[model samples]
Target: MKILANDGLDQSGIDALTAQDFEVITQKVDQKDLPEFINTHQIKIILVRSATTVRKELIDVCPSIEIIGRGGVGMDNIDVEYAREKGIHVINTPSASSESVAELVFAHLFSGARFLQDSNRKMPLKGNTEFASLKKAYTAGIELRGKTIGIVGMGRIGQEVARIALGLGMRVVAADNNVGKASIKVKFYNNQYINVDIETEPLAEVLQESDFITLHVPAQKNGFMIGEDEFALMKTGVAIVNCSRGGVIDEKALLQALDSGKVRFAGLDVFINEPTPDNQILNHPKISLTPHTGAATLEAQDRIGLSLAEQIMNLLKNK
Candidate 1:
């Protein structure tokens, strides 16, 4: 069988697939030419990350494709239901990158709490000239311990974030309309563990009470999840982190909140317009930014690759 990892799969996954006699191709294929390329190459499986889109039109034209695998979570980039309805196997590794993304949430959270993002930008320019003034400005950082962190989703990633929060001794309040209750098992370096049970509450309660809020849910279908009204409900100086999806929170509302002191800081990995995100948001002094890289860690990519290889072999090796 032949596979085209349009967005590139980890070498570990590529090796695994090749060991099973599957030919794996890792190269950039233009979106406009994907259908022709698949047909000409007779590729049996197509693997994508966030960049490529395997929509109905591509699926309709590429009959040789037997399976569509996403290396990371979220099938929003691909037309999942439409492909599956046409008898094409659609698969993703939703749990593989959960820890990596959760860790990234904390990365942003930490940056925001300590004003590290702003500090880094200023230290290089004003460290010698305004040492005392800079020191005074960044002296009022908040500690993570004993603070409340509200998780907006209770899925795998959300649960991982909760585990980290519990391990750090922070209070966790989660809201997931779908999940009523979940358990987080925190393991220490010495192998001891603590099991914490999490009972979800309503979104409003979480918004009103949490000292820091992190969003881990899928993108809202109609509009942004956190908008003007939602921002108004949040505690003053509440920090927000969004690693789940772009446009999950309203950018305009967020900017207003930051300016009005309703929101203190924001840690953002994803944005409303990706690749070419808004210059204003990029230049915002209060926002800690990272290009959509929640699952870009080495461990996560390897896990995603190995898992993808296994699934691809099971589904298409014989076909």
Candidate 2:
């Protein structure tokens, strides 16, 4: 079987495929040339990340493709339902990168609370002259120990975040349409773990009660999930973090909230339009931003590759 890792696959995945005597192509293919390349190579499986788009048009043109694999959680880049309707298996390693994404959520949450992003950017330029002033400016940081962190979606990633929050001595409340409750296993540095049961609350209740809100929901089909009304329900000066899908939170509403002091700080790893996020939020003083790299850790990539390889082997091998 032939597989094209168009957006680039990790070495672990490539080795796994090679061990099974499968041909794995890691060449970069332009969107325009994808159909021709797939047809020419007789590729049966196509793997992608966020950079590549696997829409219905491409899937229709490439008749040989039997499976579509995504390296991360979101399948926004791929037309999953359309592909599945045509008998193509669409697979993603949702659990593989949970820890990595959870860590990034804290990275932003901790840094934003302490004003690290601003300090890092300004320190180099003004540290020599304004060191004492900068120190005093950031001293009003919030401590996460006793704060409440509301998770919007309590899936694998959300549960992982909850684990970290619990370990930090923070209160965790989550809201999910599908999940009523979840048992999170919090692990400590001493190699000990404890399971805690948490019951999910209503969206409005979570919003009104939490000191910090983190989003882990899927991309909304119609419009923004958290906009003016949702923002209004939230606690004043609440810090928000979104490392999930773009278009889940309205960027314009977020900016306005920031301006009005309704939202104290925002940590965003995903944006409405990736690669080119809104300039206003990018330049905002109260926002901490990262290029959608929640699942970019080395360990996450390796796990993603291994998981994809195993799934591919199960489906395509011995066929």
Candidate 3:
């Protein structure tokens, strides 16, 4: 069996596949080289991160490929249903990066409240006293305790976020359309969606009421989920954190909110475009920007890579 991996895999992952007498290929192949490589190797499986797009065009090119494995969560980059229609099994390691993503949300929460990036950038190069004075201004960070945190999704990742938030003495309000009352132990609000407490109101209520709002939902099928109107509905000076898919929140709408003082701060680990070459928010003083490193931790990489390897190996054995 042959597998083509777009991104490099860790040593353990490589060893696992090699142990199964499977050949794994890791190359810097762009879209042009994909079809040829698939045909030449008679590739049975392909593993990719966000960098590769498993669209209908690419799927059409590699009919011999029987399975696709995404190293992390979010199949937005891959054409999942389309792959299914073509009789290709699509598997993703959703749990592999859950902790990494949850940690990122906490990281952003701290960065927003403390203004770490701004303080780091403004510290004087030569004047120690000036730097000391500037650092004092950033000390006005808000405490997370006693604050109401609203989680928009209550799935695995969202539940993890809630657990952490509760541990920090922050009240958690979850709103999910799919989850029912018995599904969650947390207190549910009245007249809301079935399971999720806090009476699942529209998105606007979540934005307006919570002291902090974190989005954990997958990407929407349309233009954008959180747009200008949604931003407008948010409480003034509310901080927003997004570690999910980039298009989930409208970047333009967020910028406008930041400009008008509607939003106090934003911490973004993902953007609408992966590897944003000309990211406008990189230098935004109020926005904390990371290079999509939510799942870049050593532990996360090991788990995701090994998990993907295991799934791929299982598919090969079953075939």
Candidate 4:
């Protein structure tokens, strides 16, 4: 059997599949040429990350494909139901990258809280010349120790964030469409751990009370989850981070909020128009940007690859 990892797979994953006599191909096949390549190679399985799209059109042409796998959590890029309806197996690695993504969330949160994002940029340009003036400008940094962190989605990633927040002595409040409450297990380096019960609150309530907000929701198929009205519900001078899907928070509304001083700062890992994000958001001084690297860690990539390999092997064995 042959698997086309269109967006590339980790070596561990490739090795695992190859050990089972499966040929794993990591060539960068253009979207327009995928059908031809799959047909030519007779690919039995297809694996993809965010860079590739597995819509109904491609699915219709790739009749030899037995399984369509997403390397990360969300299946928004794939036509999941349509593929399953065609008697094809659709799988995703939901738990694999949770810890890695959760850590990046804090990377943004900490940078925002301590003025590290702004200072890093400014200090290199004016550190020696305007040392005293630079120090005066960044003195209003906030602390995350006692601040409240609102998690917009209480899935695996959200729970990880909650665990980290609790460990840092910060209050964790979360809101999810499905989950009412969750038990977050905080692990210490000394092998001590504690279970903290967190009840999911209403979105408005979470928005109103939280000092910092981080999103972990699935892609919104219909429209923006956090729009103007949602922004209105948040506290004044709130710090927001979106490592989830792009357009989850209205970009226009976010800019307005940032300009008006309603939102103190924003950390954005995803964007509405990826690869070519809006210049207004990118150029904004108050926003910290990363090009959708939430699950780009080495550990996460390895975990995703191994998880996909395991699931594929198990499913193929059953077949």
lDDT of each: 0.93, 0.94, 0.81, 0.93
Ranking 1 against 2 by TM-score, winner:
1
Clashing pairs in 3: 180-195, 181-195, 188-197, 189-198, 192-199, 192-200
Q: Kindly indicate the candidate among 1 and 3 with the higher TM-score.
A: 1
Which pairs clash in the backbone of model 4? none
lDDT of 3: 0.81
Across 22-107, the per-residue lDDT of candidate 2 in tens digits comes to 89999999999999999999999999999999999999999999999999998988999999999999999999999999999999
Task: Please write out the lDDT profile of model 4 over residues 83-182, one tens digit for every residue.
Answer: 9999999999999999988999989888877778888899999999999998998889888999999999999999999999999999999998799989
Tell me how many clashing residue pairs each candidate has: 0, 0, 6, 0
TM-score (C-alpha, index-matched) for candidate 3: 0.89
**Model 3 lDDT tens row, 67-172:** 9988888898899999999999999888988878888898888888898768767764524768667766777788889998878877777877876776677877
Poorest stretch of ten by lDDT in candidate 4: 109-118
Candidates ranked, most accurate by lDDT first: 2, 1, 4, 3
- TM-scores, all candidates, are 0.98, 0.97, 0.89, 0.98
Candidate 1, pairs of clashing residues: none
